[model samples]
Structure formats: C-alpha cells, structure tokens
Target: MNPREHIPVLLEESLALLDIGRDGIYIDGTLGLAGHAEEILKRNPRARLVGIDLDDRSIRKAQARLQPFEDRVDLYHADFKCIPELDIDFPAVRGILLDLGMSSYQLDTADRGFGHSQEGPLDMRMDDRNKLTAAKILDKYPEPKLAQLFREYGELKQAAKLARKIASVRRTQKIESTTHLRGLVEEVCHWIPQRGKIHPAAKVFQALRIEVNQELQGLGEFLIEAIGLVGPGTRLAVISFHSLEDRIVKHTLARLSRPEYGDSVIDILTKHPVVPSEDEVARNPRSRSAKLRAAVKRPHGS
Candidate 1:
C-alpha cells in the first residue's frame, strides 16, 4: 500500500481543536505520510508546518506527499522527543499534533514486521536506525523481564505463562519470525472463539514493539516539550491508538490543566477523548481504536 492511501485517524476532531490560524505555525510530531499535515495546510494556506518523524521511510513519503507545500512545510527526520532542541525560526508555534499509532504503511509492509498475520522477520523497529529489534528482545530477555514487558506494556493477563513458554522454546531454537512468535503465544494462550475477539498474539506483539522502539519511554517528556514550544491559547492534540498511550496523554493534560501543577499551563478541551464517528470508522477500520485528546495552553498570567 502506498503512503498516500493512508487515512489519518481522528482528522476532523484534531483539526477542529487546533483552530488553525492563517499565519500560524504548527508542528506535526508524528508526520506519518503527512496526511494530517496536508489537511492542515489545505485549510490554512498561509500557515507553516514543521513535520517530524523517526522513520526515514515516513519522512521520505511525507516529503513526497507534501512536495507541493514544500515552501510552507519543513520536514525533519528526527524523533518528536527532540522537539525542544529543534532550532527553527518560528516566532511561536500555534499548535502541535502527535498521532501515536503505527502508520498503516508500517503495518502493511511485510518486511517491516509490525503485523503478525504477515510472514516476516520479527523486526519491529520504528526507526531502522534503532539497533534493538523484537527478535533480539525475545532472544535476549530472561523470563522474568519478558513477563514484566508483557504485563506493563501489553497489559496481558497471561504474561508470566507466555514468558515461560518463550523462555523454554528459545533455549533450543531462536524466535526469529513473526509466525514463530505468534505460534508460541497461541500455544500458551489459546484463542477465544468469540466474534471480534482480538488475536491471542496481538498484545504480545504490541509489548515487543513498544520495548524495541522505546515508544512510551520519552512520551511525557515530549508532551511537556511540545507544550513549552507553543504560547498561551495555542492548542495541542494527540491521537493515541491504545489504552496505555491514551492514559499518558490523558494524565499529562490533566496535570497541566490543574492549578496545583504550577501555572495551569493547559486547559483541557476534551474531558473525555473524542472518538471517531461510525461513518469514519466504517471507512477506516484502523481508526476504530483511536482516542483524541486536546488542550489549549492557558494565558501566562491566567
């Protein structure tokens, strides 16, 4: 599948919250294919955008997709966590957006190894530059540490059992492919027969991917830094695909919204996350799990 065919999750809700100004400067922290960035620029032709992504493939695709707006868009091949360190000349950022879900391109590409249904090597690094891969994690991590990773990142109930299964199996043979790992998970945690039930190995795959990419490690730090880059009344919107990511965005915005948390830097705009409508979800099944949370920075004195 081409990057241009990828549909962004919660596009309308995020853009509504951003309230794009004609001459405003915005940052798309996870510029996967520039889907949302293109919409933003389309809505406000005079606005400028800074798009950042860790995946070189995404940067290349986004650059191509946004080529028409090259004069107004600056694409960077960097992690969103480095936003604060960026030396851009924008007077003040008017908005920031981070869609923390794996792009469809990443999941659909068999060699990228983000999906279990595909027969590929168990390499789920978001950035090809990252040395750690899911295969390496499974091969090297001990039973106890693997259990912890599954429990914390995946929230899997049978984490210990799955870890023990991997530990026993890996002693004689390495778990090098997505198929091998999926089989191990199915062996330990039998699949439920209920309709719409998620795959038995889904959570395990998520845990390994998170561990390999350190996706959750610097998330809070990045949110804080992104907030700092914007001025009072500027908005920030984050669309997270899973509960773990949504929880982080929810709590970070909450803390910033509270008066006790110093300047009350942010005022929560959505008390509950904005979910996609039935029509949108029908058109894009991948958007079903998305949760969008937005907040506006309070004026400095207020």
Candidate 2:
C-alpha cells in the first residue's frame, strides 16, 4: 500500500460544522498528511492554517503536501493538547479540528509497530522520542499491571488471562517483537478467525499503543482549556476513532454546553455524533469506526 495516500474521515461533515468563512485563522490540531488542512485551504483562499502534530515524520509530510500554501500556513511539531498553552491568536481563530486516530501511514509502515498482523519490533511510540515502548511495557510491567492496562485501555474480556500468559512467556524470553506479542495474545484468547469478529491481538496492540503514547491522558482538560481560550463563534470539530475517546468528547461537549452564572461555554453543534457515509467507508475501510462531534463557543457575557 502507498503510505502517502490518506482519506480524511467525515470530510464534508467536519467542514460543515467548522462553517468556514472568509479571511479567518483555522487550526488543524492533528494535521495528519494535511488531508483536511489542504481541503480547508483549497476551499477558502483567504483563510490561514495553523497545523500541529506530535509525529515529526507526519509534520514533514504535511509540510511538503501543503507547500502550495506555505506562505499562509504555520506548522508545529507538537501535541494538540499543548495548543492551549502555545502562543496562538485565540480570538481570531475561526475553526479548529482534532482528528484523534492513528494515521494509515503509521500503521502501514512496518517499522512503526502499530499494526498487529505485521512483524516489527515492539516500539509503538507515536512520538519516537518517548522513552516508553511496547517492549518496555511488556518487559517491565507486572502481570497485574498488564491486566489493568488491557482491561482499562483495550477493554478486553480476557485481559487477566492474557497478562498471565505474557508474564509466563517473559520469564525465559523477552517479548521483543510485534508478532511475538500478537502470537501470545492469540494463543491466550483461543485463536479464531471468523467473519465480523475482531482479533484479540488488535486489542492487545491498541492497549500497548495507548500506554506507549499516553493517548487518553489530559484529553478532557485540553478540550475545556481550548473552549475557554477561543472566541465566541469559533467552532471545534473532533473526530475520534474509538468509543473511549468518543465518550470523552461527548461528555466534555455536554458539560461545556451547560450554563454557569447565566453563561455557557459552547453551543453543541452536533446533537448526535456524525458517522462516515457508506461510500466513504467503502473507499477507506480504516475510516469505518470514525465519529465526528462539534460545538461552537458562546459569548462570555451572553
């Protein structure tokens, strides 16, 4: 597969919620391959983009892809959670988008260790600078800690049994490879390949990936901070791939929509989460699980 190919999930739905207008600043918090960013720029000639991503490789790719609008674009190689702290023009910003999902480029690449079916070293750090690796977690974490990680992050049913199996295996040989860990999960979960059933190894990989990157940490706080920073009418669109993230986004938006001292933070734009169309799913199978939610900030004194 060509890793360069990327299809942004719920593209039209996200753009509609953003309600892109003329001559305003926009932010792409998770600018993976500049797919959504490019679309924004392409549609609005007067708009400027501020793109951020934790992956340096992805940033470089986005840079080259967005070369046409380099003069009007600002790209940052950092996590989206830090945007609230970063020196940004908060009030003038028109829209912001956060697509929280592993890009196809990362999964398709063999060395990234994000895919379970492929054989690679167990290094699942989204930002490679992070000291934590999937191998380190497998090698260092005790059986109970491993169980907790799988149970909480992956929501796996056989977490304890799988953890016990990993603990037993690591006693003699170090769990160093993706295939090594995947095989253990399959064995412990009782190997089965049936239609419409997800593989146990996928859950194991997801748990490890979340741990390695600390993906869910501080997400709700970031949303609150961002909503408070942006001006009234600024729209925030978020596309979350898994239920855990979707739940957090949903609850946070709901909380922000309530009034405090006769002033609410945002008006919920998406009453229900928007999902991908059937044609989009057929075009990009990886986007099938995506759900998009959005809200617009309300006036402070209103």
Candidate 3:
C-alpha cells in the first residue's frame, strides 16, 4: 500500500453534515493525507481551511496533496486540542471536523508501530517529539499499573492475565518489538476461534498506543473548545473509531444540546451516530467500526 494513500471514511456524509458554503473558513482537526481536505476544497472552491495534525509526516503529506489550495489553506504542526490558540478568530470559522482514528499511512508504515499484524519497533508515539513509547511503558510500568491500563483503555477481558504474562516475560528479556509483545499476549490470552476472528493481541496494542499518546486524556475539553470556536448555525462533526472515543463524542454533544444546560448551545443533528453502509465497509474494511456524530451550534440566545 502506498504510504500516502488514505480513503477518508464517510466522506459524503461528513460533507453533507458540514454544509460547506461558498466562501467560509473550515477546520480539519486531524488532516491525515489531506483526503477529506482535498475534497472539501474541490467542492467549495473558495472555502479556506485550517489543517492540523500531530504527526509531522502526515503534515508533509497533506502539504503536498493540498498544494493546489496552498493560498487558501493554513497547515499547522500542532495538536487539535490547541485550536483555540491558532491566530484565527473563532467567530469567522464556519465548520470543524475531528476524525479520531489513526490513518492507514500511520498503521501500514512499519516504522510508526501502530499495527499488531506487522513487525515494528514498540514505539507508538503519534507525535515523534513525545518522550514516551510503548516499549518504555512496558519496561517501566508495574504489573498492577499495566493491568489497569489494559482494562481501562483497551477494555480487555483478560487484562490481568496479559499483564502478569508481560511482567514475567520482561524479566527474562527486554520487550523491544511489536512481535515480542504480541507473542506474549497470544500466549496468555489463548485465542478462541469460536469467540471471534479478531487477534488476541489487538486490544493490548490499542491500549499501549492510547497510553503512549494520551489520546483520551483531554478529548472532552478539546470538544468544548472546538464548540466555542464555531459561530451560530455552524456545524461540528466528529468520527470516532472505538467505543472509548465514541462515548466521549456522544456524551459531550448530548450535554451541549440539552435545554436544561446553560443556554442550549447546540442542537444534536444525529440522534444516533451515523455509521458507514455495507458498500462502504466492503470497499474499505478499516471503516467498518467508524461512527460519526454531528451537531450545529444554536443561533445565539435563541
């Protein structure tokens, strides 16, 4: 697979929810490979964009793919949580999109270490600038702490057994690569063919990635800040891959839409999250788990 290739999940549905206008500013908070950004620019020729991504490699790829709209787009090498600090005035922004899934490029690239099916270094930092790595977490965390991480982040049923196995293995040799850790998980979890076809180590890898990047730590706060940045009637859409992220998006949007909450800032556009259709799933299997929820800001004081 080409490292630059990424099929933007739920592209048409997201565009419809965003309601892109003729000449307004839009923000793609997780601009991976410019897949969605390119389409947005194509649909609304005069629309300007603010693209943000933590991965420098992604930023570079986005820059190249979106070069045709260079004059209208501002690419930033920063976390989406820091959107409020971007010099742009929030009142003028028309739309905001947050896709909380890792891109195909990040996962397929062996060096980035996000996949369980391939061999790579146990380094899962989304931002290479970060000090922590999955290997470091395995080496430093105590058995109890490791168990908690797996249970809380991955929602794994055998977290304790997996943690104990890792602790015992690391004593004999350093857990330096993806294969080593995956082997440990398979040994402890004992994959059951009847349960599901999913790999036993999948959850463990996901848990480590979440911890290494602190992905869920400030998500709700970021959503609040993003909501504040849009003006009246402007929409915010988020695509979350896992239940942990989907829950956050669901509850935050629900809270802001309630009349009992101060001022009723938003109106939930989708009562239930929108999921990809069977055709979309067939075309891109990775998008099978994605769920998108959108809300539009209520007219001020209405």
Candidate 4:
C-alpha cells in the first residue's frame, strides 16, 4: 500500500497536543504509515524521530515515505511495547506518541484479516513475526481459554456461547479465513438481531485481533517504561480508538503525573482528552472514535 494515500485520523489534534520541539528527540511508537512522523519531522529540522511498528508492511511503507527525512529519522521494525529497549540514545526524549489501532490500510488490504467484510486468511498478527494467528487460536485454544479471551477483549455478553460455537465448528473444519469465522459468529450469535449500526461479527473480529496482537497484555508495562524516558519539559501523547485502550492510557498517565507520594515528576496536560473536532470528524469519519490524551514531565523537584 502507498503511504501518502494513508490519512491518519486526528492528525492536527495530535500535533497540537504533542507540542513538538525543534531539536527534540521523539518517538512515534506506533508508526503505522508514518503519517504522524512525517508531520513531526517537517515541523522541525533539528528534531530526531524514532519510528517503530511491528507490521513489516507498515515499516516498508514508512521507510519509503519518510526517506527524505533520513537525516532525522530512524525506523525500527519491532513492537511498540519494546521501545524502551531500543538502542537509540537521546539525552531525553521530547515527546512520545502512540496511535494504537490497526491502520486503515491494514483493514482495507483484506489479506491482512483485520476486517470481517473481506475474505482472507484468518491470520490477524499485526507483526507477521508473531507466531499466534487467529486461526491457530480458534483451532488450538481450549474452549474455556477462548471464552475468557472473548469476554475480556471483546467485552462480548455471550462469550461462552460464542466460544462453544467456535469450538464445535472448528472440530469439523479449520476456521481458516475471515469469511468462515464471520459465518460461524452469525450462526452462534442469533440473538444479536439482524439490524444494527455495527456488523454482528464486529465484536468477534475485534476479540481475535486483540488476542492475536496481545494488545492489552503488555500495555501497562510499556506505558510505564515509555513515560519514564521523558525528561522534564517533554510531553507524552496517546491516541486510543476504544475504551479498553483509552482506560489503560488514562490510568497510566494519571499515575505518573499524580503528586501524592513524595512529589510526582509529571503533570497531566489534558484534564479532558482532546478529541477530533466536528469538522475533522466530518472530513474523516474514522477520527470520530479517536481520543487523544497528553501529559508533560514536571521539572525535577517541584
């Protein structure tokens, strides 16, 4: 997929809240199409950016898209959760941005198995390096384990019933594709009704994607480690698409900025999250679900 064609949701709002510095070090933790990184680099000639993404396709596209800024950007083909371990050493990172969600390109590609509307392999690993795929989980995971995953990740009301249906169907044939799984979900979730804003398979696909990527498992640790890298005067911004991810970012930033125990080292910048304006939402409907939260590192000792 071409990088320039990718329109990142809430781009203007994100840059405004991040407050990019001219000579600062920055990290685009989820550099989907490098759309945000491109803007950050263009804003400041001296600013250096470390762009990370687990998806190889995104890395390739970003590498090509951000080529002109080679002097200031270093691309990493790794998971965002491991950013703290990357070798790039800047005295202090000016800001870090995490835009956490499957990019539109990924969903639109169809072969990536991110969207249920398309027919493709049921492989939902954002990073192809990851061993677990949605198909493997459906075929191998125990019914109880699958039920738990659906319940926790999808917040689906009928997780147990859905899990049972998947288990039974998989016994007859491998659930090898998105269409196959969608059909199975419809068979099991008859109570969801035929009419609604969202497709009935939406929750199931969402659960599988979360489980395949381990999206929530290491998020808390990742956020804690990344925030600690910000020096005084630096800011951190996170754009989350759903409540599950938003809650994680909200609580993690709050904990870092809170000043109860012996003076905190950070201050919450956005008491309320910065969401897309009505105009932006109208221009790009995808931006409607985005919620951006920001915080800044406090100077040492009050």
- For model 1, the stretches where C-alpha displacement exceeds 4 angstroms are 1-4
Model 3 misplaced regions, further than 4 Å:
1-4, 192-196
Of the two candidates 2 and 3, the one with more favorable lDDT, higher being better, is 2
Per-residue alpha-carbon lDDT of model 4 for 1-302, expressed as tens digits? 45434678778778877888547788999999999999999888888999999999989988888899998888889988888788867455788889998888888888889889889999988989899999999999999999998888887778999899988887788989999888877777773655535665888888899989988888877777766665677777899988898999898888877776333357888899889888887777767789988887787788
Positional deviation of residue 51's Cα in model 3 after best superposition, in angstroms: 0.3
lDDT on C-alpha atoms for all candidate structures = 0.87, 0.89, 0.88, 0.83
- Clashing residue pairs found in predicted model 1: none
Candidate with maximal TM-score: 2
Q: After superposition, how far is residue 224 of candidate 2 from its true place, in Å?
A: 0.4
Per-residue lDDT over 113-137 for candidate 3, one digit per residue giving the tens place of the 0 to 100 score: 8898899999998899999999999
* Model 2: residues with Cα > 4 Å off, grouped in runs: 1-4, 261-264
Candidate 3's TM-score: 0.96
Each prediction's TM-score versus the true structure: 0.96, 0.97, 0.96, 0.94
**Model 4 — which ten-residue stretch has the worst lDDT?**
191-200
| lDDT, candidate 1, 160-220, per-residue tens | 9999998998889999999988888887888655789888688888999899889888898
RMSD of each candidate? Answer: 1.5, 1.5, 1.6, 1.9
How many clashes in each structure?
0, 0, 0, 0
Please tell me which predicted candidate would have the highest lDDT against the true structure. 2
Order of candidate numbers by TM-score, starting with the best: 2, 3, 1, 4
Residue 158 C-alpha lDDT in model 2? 96
